[model samples]
Target: MTRAYLAFTETGLALAKRLAVALPGSVARCGRDGVSLAEWASAQFVHSDALIFVGAAGLAVRAIAPHCKSKTTDPAVVVVDECGRFAVPILSGHLGGANDLARAIAAVCGAVPVITTATDAHGIFAVDEWAKHQNCMVLEPERIKLVSGKLLAGQPVYYRADFPVMGTVPAGLFLADTPEKADFALTLCPTGQALHLVPRIGVLGIGCKRGTSAETLEAAFAAFCTRYGFAAQAVTAAASIDLKQNEPGLLAFCQAHGWPVRFYSAAQLRSVPGQFTPSPFVQSVTGVDNVCERAAVLDADGSLFYPKFACSGVTLALACRPFAPDWRWQNA
Candidate 1:
């Protein structure tokens, strides 16, 4: 569903076409003789996840200047020369993935990637980039600059993780035993501390009575997470029995939070092995001894971090993915 737009002038239209062919699901847009470049670029910026301008860097800057927002929301913007000699990420380089996109484009065009991010240039680990790679939500994204700045200045940045992290720790980052002693921390649960990176690794398994109001479900879910130290931003998905697939409150809650819901059949739920709370009434009605626990760990091998907690006619459980260090971009 990701759409990339390639905008080009007459001099670079052929190269843009080649790039469009190289990148699947990409659209090649050229400035017509009568259309204004600014207007055309503006339209592309609004409609695309990434914009590649096959022309001057000045043109790319001027086109995106009016529409540029924060790195969190802006689309990746890359500028390539008409001869395809260099690919430069002009805006939203790290958080928006412009740097990676530029490198890919450069590789295809046999050109050089002109990445200038301080961390990338100096071969230091960028926390923001790593968080993005891990599908984690940075609660305080501004603090990333503070941590990266420390590393850039040759000051060791301390870190702590609640779960086991594999692979050798990147240079410039040291592991600390406690949050108080660390410069920053990585966790799935809330710590009420600043400079913490929360990974989106929690899955919620929910069961609700029919006709439950969305408000009731929301309040109960929020309370359950708050009571158990779960970070709301760390929740990545939800699950429930297939029988409740059309339940209005459940659907509404997941949809509102942009979490995808996975529905398991009674047989599917029964096949998962775990020590789950069994309810005769639930089994009589749904043909499954448990829904919340089984649904939470259906697809992945995970631990039931939070057992079933019931409130306001709703039952909930939580599961966590195994922690693994992502070191693919350590030197990039």
Candidate 2:
């Protein structure tokens, strides 16, 4: 669990104590009231995901904002009254903020929670959480900010493949067709279909030996991700498993990646029209199919451009696309 810090007036210290008991992570309280604001802020800066202020909103904001990381990927900030009856999400929900924590506090204190972020209210795809689950790195975190800005202002967000996002479009901005133009574009796993906007595809592919151990597979996959600059969460789906479902390695791979193993049966592969290639070993071992050939064949809506590298044992494919403007996470 991430560490959380609470700096409150004497009246609010009891609330902080309650929070420390309920929230499993480490918690701290501010010292003497007369201490310098800088001293207070700096004291809790280490490894704390949130800075909770129990009183004096203006002072709390000013004192911590300057100390926060410039881009603010960590250490969210919040403010509440001494009664603990009103909780406000001041910063950093996606990077670990007081949004949920504040809400938890509010539930305990019966306070009103102020959460204005669209994703949380609408219950859509939280790109950051997905990234966290997949262990994928975000190339451009600010793009999500721009995307949310447009959404909050009632702008249209276009998804090439209807990728689920946090908020709904505000009517006027949603463009249904390619208008020979668009305000912004989002691609979902590159279908090669004629899209009005630029393509942004997320891909997941996998390969594996007949009987690789689950532990070996997981360690190898993690190492593979670290070695190649890629986020595990960006994996949209598992691309192969038909011949290897019985293999513990393949099943473990699917579970680890949080994807349903999409197997292409031999008959299904035969139906998919492609410049299909077959390997002797693949045909001999699996008896019914080829892995890459089947994957390419199955992806009828989009063309599969095979990279020149061969992943031995078990192969798990993931999107290589760096995150774009729409794919971002922010504090709620």
Best TM-score among the predictions, by candidate number: 1
Deviation of model 2 at 17, angstroms: 1.5
Tell me the spans in candidate 1 whose CA falls farther than 4 Å from its real position: 33-47, 330-332
Worst 10 residues of 2 by lDDT: 189-198
C-alpha RMSD for every candidate: 2.4, 9.9
Model 1: per-residue Cα lDDT over 92-198, one tens digit each: 78777888888888878898999999999998888888877766677777787888899999998888877666677889888876677776677767464547677
lDDT values for all models: 0.80, 0.56
**Residue pairs that clash (backbone atoms under 3 angstroms), model 1:** none
lDDT of 1: 0.80
- What lDDT would candidate 2 get against the real structure? 0.56
The TM-score values for the models, in the order shown, are 0.91, 0.48
Provide the lDDT at 48 for model 1.
Answer: 76
Stretches of model 2 off by over 4 angstroms after superposition: 1-3, 32-40, 43-46, 70-72, 93-97, 115-139, 144-146, 162-332
